[model samples]
Target: MRIIPREEWGARHGDGRYWTTLPASEVWLHHSVTVAPDTVPPWTDDFEAIRTIERIGAQRFGSVYGFPYTFGITPAGLIFEGHHIAKTGAHTYGHNTIGRAICLVGNYETDEPTELQLDAVAWLLRHGQAQGWWREARLDGGHRDLTATACPGRHAYAAIPRINARATQPIGGGGASPSTGGAQRRYLQEESTMQLQPGKHGQYRSIPDGATRVIVGCPHGQMSARIIWHGPGYPSTHDMDTRWPDFDWVAKDAVHNTIHRLRPWRVPIPEKATGFALYWDYPPVEGHYDDYTGEVSFEF
Candidate 1:
């Protein structure tokens, strides 16, 4: 029942953000799905993982109020404190004042969280409630529960029932309803990159055949001119600055780690349109590169 203190992991001081009393109301779960290869990595130990998230969160939120989530856990069952329970989190917006975010280490979309990781999460929740860190906090749900995101990924999210069922409280739900909106999901290669020589005629690549809607995830905060996607390769090929009307530009749990996170840009293909590619209409600038080559993908 021991949570590694943030100071031990070198967490920065908060700017007196959402400081709350003990036994907070709700509990939210998440997967770090961290972007930016430079920052996210398999650290030597679980504590290092917290340090890394701290560094990224620091830059994201600001050195003063950087650390986003309230806690972090690795696959090895190690629980590290982020902001103390009383310290309300910057984890989920709107709901920030209400709940604390506990994040699982690996990306759950494709990677499976180990049993040890789940065990640690369940244990932490029970411990928190018993210690008056939260108000009988329940494993409310994954990050996707409170927002629009593929966070806590399918695999980890799918495992929620298993964790809650084993917890002190009786479980009732099995996470969000399983729905893919009818169309089968299709994916572009991961971390694929394209060079945009400013004025050069940008680049184009077709999506999978039946992909009616594509949820494209691009590195956040860089759509200005760098790594911008200008709709389909139709009429004018559009510009990167403005979003295509049809495409639903949904920003995931970003704003904190904009540089490192890949925000989702959901694009719906026109019915009559024959072909499509995430048209990257480069702007007229000197020289800029989108080296997030392997950092691109879509699930439609």
Candidate 2:
């Protein structure tokens, strides 16, 4: 992974005060919504573009908080160091302490990031883990996953699973892949009988002993789904409604509906765990939006 240091990018340091020195356990991906200043198509080189972004961020967030992220990635796939990882950023509220934020260069709601850019993200993650920067980091999610904003836009967010999978691959091909025997395949194909009542907050069910993955889906688009499990230390939760807006109504033909496919390898679930739970919440409505129905599939 090619990492461009702050010195190389001509970035200034913060005031020397840091929140803490703990390594990050989560990485949050985001997209810079700002466009270039004055050009025919509003395009700028990566260096100047990131510089502009930093200056703007300083002006906006520097007064109260430091730069909002630990790193920024350019369109050309070069990673730039922003705030030092030791300092807590204002990137994601309620999670700045534990999460490292990496903002991609451009808005991706309408535009798709290049393949090189996605590959760079994966490579950076792998590099961080190898360097012990975030050796305990296993969860890689978008900024919107923890917040209500449409950051790290839909197209960019869609690439997170693939990026995470690539990052977790063995360095020189030694790690074993998950087994997919006929029994396991049969478990995945088994239809879900669990039905979520409207306005229900949480539900729990016991999973098969050797289940490796949990697939959760909510067809009603307007609602949000979260899958939580009791593990060794504390309960861990993965938010499902990151890419789509909370209350936006979706047509039946919409390209992507709301779904959360929890791969235990990516989002770690306790090995000794027996049961898991599903928690969902939505905006209050006076009339009917859509009857909320969720399904959970466990793969053994």
Candidate 3:
């Protein structure tokens, strides 16, 4: 959990060191997507990507004194200090005062994070909580969730829980981050199968109170099964809000059969979420489910 100071990293704007209060309320996750993930990984390249980030920060928001995030994590699992928890950081725009941001190096959309990277990020979070940088060390969500940009990238965004879970290490052993809104251990635990029909109003399954992962499994495999997410409002199956054009009853396996060889289609969802529903829909696409049924599986 050692963080390389800016001085050690040869930061150009390390002069104006400042401080804030302890135990930040929110932890914002981000990814340095600008760097080609394979452009020589950090294990040997030192902090070149970090330097690029600092250069970009200097160019975009000249007023900001130094790097935006409180910390920068390399793919090699190195933690570099930008701004300390008490110090005001330029990340997360208006939320800087209360939020501590950690930017993971690489574009996770195309690059799957390495185990070392994940473990390092988790260690940082856990260390923050254990050291009293933040009381609960709440993970407010990724930068994309708070703003318009896809900052953290899809793969990095999906690993938030794993980060939280790994950061759940015992304080004596290492560090800790904010637990996922009090969920000390958030993992993919399967739930019972839920059956949903097309365009049914007020017809949704009741998931457990904590956040969950939704997987649409099509035992039928790659047929005419398509479904979309339904929030607390439970939008109709055909609503444009569900991002569907026709009847919304498609299954998951059917959708991924082409690329994934019929792996269960995983639906992107919010962290620590509640009030959700699955809207079944069907489109003009070819093929049909073998069993004529698409099942929804819940995991947490």
Candidate 4:
């Protein structure tokens, strides 16, 4: 609930350009084009990175990037408020009129943010929802959808519906389809990262070919298992908080904190694991050598 004011949050671009703002009506989602490092440890925890984006936006375009209400998901799963919601932001051209924007750090074209980034974003969205920011808020759409430009990016824009779904679901009911009572799943798909898969001992099962899992134990130390299936009524990946409701498991020894040597592993894919949501960078994968190496197998 604590928001840093614009005066304190930004400075005139070296070009002497100032930031802009947008009136907040609904929460808009976006990807920051800052091209961040693959790993930010605890992203939101880094205050400088957040400032840098605004600085760049202001310098390049003579205005701060994104909307004032725009927030960002740090590489470490922390939510950071970029600008003031009541003020206008320079993020989008037309969409800024009725939307408060959220920009995820990192360049989607060149790199994907870590699990921490996703978690931070989801956290911010939920917070806004809890505060009734979206009760009447319409999600973000392209300038072309309303006016012009290919802003918000393709993949980032595609995630809007899912993002809205995660924000609107009923508490303790589970997933996007609350009425179905089906469990929602999230996937961790960064190049090199480890997540806890849902499975157990005596239940050797093939983790299909491509399923997403979470990191419950450690990064990658052989204490990993393929989640056979998730229980009905489990929360969606976006709704799952990193600090709260810690992912419980029957096989806890599989997740390892650190790996001896860097190697690629697929995120543990579990059978029947549908609608997998992924975090930004929880299970830190070495970007240089750990691209697309995340998974484990258990045959039942």
* Candidate number with greatest TM-score: 3
- Over the stretch 1-300, how does candidate 1's per-residue lDDT look in tens digits? 346677655566563275777667778888887531221211223444566677777778776655678888776555678775666667787777778788887678988887656766777777777778777646788888878998889998898888876566433212211121111212322222222232223334444445554443333223322232333334544457754333323222111112222344445555544333333422332342322221223344
Task: Give lDDT tens digits, candidate 2, residues 47-161.
Answer: 5567777777778777434346778776655567877767777677787777788888888887787655666677777777777667542446788888788889999888887
Better of 3 and 4 by TM-score: 3
Identify the runs in model 1 with alpha carbons over 4 angstroms from their true place. 13-16, 35-43, 169-300
What TM-score does prediction 3 earn?
0.53
List TM-score per model, in order: 0.52, 0.52, 0.53, 0.44
TM-score of 4: 0.44
Which parts of model 4 have CA positions greater than 4 angstroms off? Answer: 1-23, 40-45, 61-69, 113-116, 136-138, 142-144, 170-300
Which candidate order results from sorting by lDDT in descending order? 3, 2, 1, 4
**C-alpha lDDT score of every prediction, in listed order:** 0.55, 0.57, 0.58, 0.42
Expressed as tens digits, the lDDT of each residue in 1-300 for candidate 3 is: 467778656577642235777778888899877763331111113344566677777776563556777888866556778765687877788777777888888888888876656777777776788789876643667999888998898888888887777767664333221122113323222234454332223234544554355566433223233334334443455646756433333222213323121345565555423334444442212353221334465554
Q: Worst ten-residue run, lDDT, model 3? A: 176-185
| Candidate 4 lDDT over residue span 1-300, tens digit each | 133334433333331123333334555556666655334221111344566676667665655343233565544444555655455566566655556667776665445555444434454556565665544333554333554544456666665565556445443222221111112213222322222232232222223234343332222322332233332223434334443222223331333333222232334444344323222223334451232223322211
By TM-score, the better pick of 2 and 3 is 3
Per model, state how many residue pairs clash. Answer: 7, 0, 25, 53
- Per-residue error (Å), model 1, residue 18: 2.5
